[model samples]
Target: MTATAKPLPAGWTIRLHRVHNLTVLTLHDEHGTDREIGFCPLTPDGPQDLTVSALDTIAHPRLREAAQNVVTSFYDRTAAARHHRDAFDRAVPDCRVLLGHLRARLPGCRADLGTDPNELTVTLTLTATTRAAGPLHALLARWPGHTGHGGSLADGIDQDLDSSGALTAALRQDRATEFLIWYRGQC
Candidate 1:
């Protein structure tokens, strides 16, 4: 009688290979499953060729619209500009708290902040170009209106210095929700 060899155990493996600026990825699963993914640094196209497309596709118009609505609602619910501005002065630390909340809840979005007693600004940008905008958009759509005017959606993306003359003490607030929505829609 002849004896046969035993097969390998169940597991997963990833292999990478490159050729002429192109990268090839191979994944093998212990259950005898295998798949390949590929990427190229160069393309045959026009001026847009300089841009790199996301490997994954995303479809989340509803989520994006929800985020926009949230921003607008936050602005409308707040009182006069001066009152909102004062609230911003009182919520500089709260802005940081909100940022942490966003990062934890929205895996693909990131927030950059600058604030002083007089101004506060937070810019949330998309970090994952390939994933669906749902999670990030949902997070932003729920941003609490109490974050203050400095933390409001109307703020722009500019760093401000505080009253102490130290860049650290500047109270400047700017929100970049539109920027995030624009990025989410980019192909």
Candidate 2:
């Protein structure tokens, strides 16, 4: 039987492209190939930023450590992609666990979970608004998870917990805010 092309998943798009002499799967966009969500080769120039972004949202230190363990373990694109996919799978359950924990710990917050192509990465977004000081501080402190040192929410608007936590002005009056956490690895 001839193998047919698999269709894109709901809410995801995939395209094939050649970059730096390597065949890469450009996921989630059909256009100019900027903002890639996944890659094959794991090259120094191949979407490492997005990969790191995905890893940073992992709440479990062990899962993060496991990803670190495999960073140098693969020699080729296929192997590395597999490794990455594995890590992403490991992190998915943990992400769900973390979401449950977050939902339990913080009232009035909403959570969403999603994945990139080949299931090599996951993104979790938690949104909440500040009606009082207590919930606001709680949201800010829970942010960035374990690996969110450089990542920020809403274009760095939430970088400073102290300043951003305070809903003092008209813009802040909206109170609704979102924190996007990404976890990347092989599926």
Candidate 3:
């Protein structure tokens, strides 16, 4: 059976090009130019073919690290891409739990968690907003969870949770003292 070629990693439109009869890795260019990045020489296998694993161990460490960085940077981008899901697999439940606890304290509280994308970048934000005030807003405004007021909602209180430490502090927050010491854990 013939070996089927696997597609290159995301953000990598690269292929093996023939440079002096040697297989060199090249990146795609909009002007149809081959930008040579690294070399992936082949073993003495008749027609001179190289495996994907073999190409990774090329002589150029910079090229290998560069390709790896391209792949690694995409790690977070794909986490929320499947089925249009939001948040990392583990963070989903934590977000839900925090939202639920806030809802219990303030029935009018609501949450929105998802990705914000532009022409070049994407970001994740998990926010909870509530119309209640006086004491409830003060409690959520603690560290880890950023609480704010005076938006379009007038009497609305906005809270955002971004780190696991903030999540843990939010979970343990039970009072609205004048100066409560919130532990953001090691997040």
Best by lDDT: 2
Summing lDDT over every window of 10 consecutive residues in candidate 3, give the lowest-scoring window.
Answer: 170-179
Model 1 segments beyond 4 Å from truth?
1-89, 114-128, 142-187
Compared with the true structure, what per-residue lDDT tens digits does model 1 show for residues 4-77? 21121236333334455443334344453443233434322222212111111112333223223332333343
Which regions of candidate 2 fall more than 4 Å away from where they truly are? 1-85, 116-120, 132-139, 142-187
> How well is each residue in 1-187 modelled by candidate 2, as lDDT tens digits?
0122123333433343446644343444234433333334433333322323233343435433333333222223335456654655553436565566666666655555433344334344345545344663455555444224464343323322245453321111011122323221211
Candidate 1 overall lDDT versus native: 0.36
**Per-residue lDDT over 1-187 for candidate 3, one digit per residue giving the tens place of the 0 to 100 score:** 1133233443445444444545555554444354225554542222233223333554455445443443333443454354344223333335455545555655544433433342111222223333444334455444433432543311222233334323212221122111122321211
Candidate 2: residue pairs that collide:
54-182, 54-183, 54-184, 84-185, 84-186, 85-186, 85-187, 86-186, 86-187
TM-score of each: 0.25, 0.30, 0.28
User: What does the lDDT read for residue 174 in candidate 3?
Assistant: 20
Candidate-wise lDDT, in order: 0.36, 0.39, 0.37
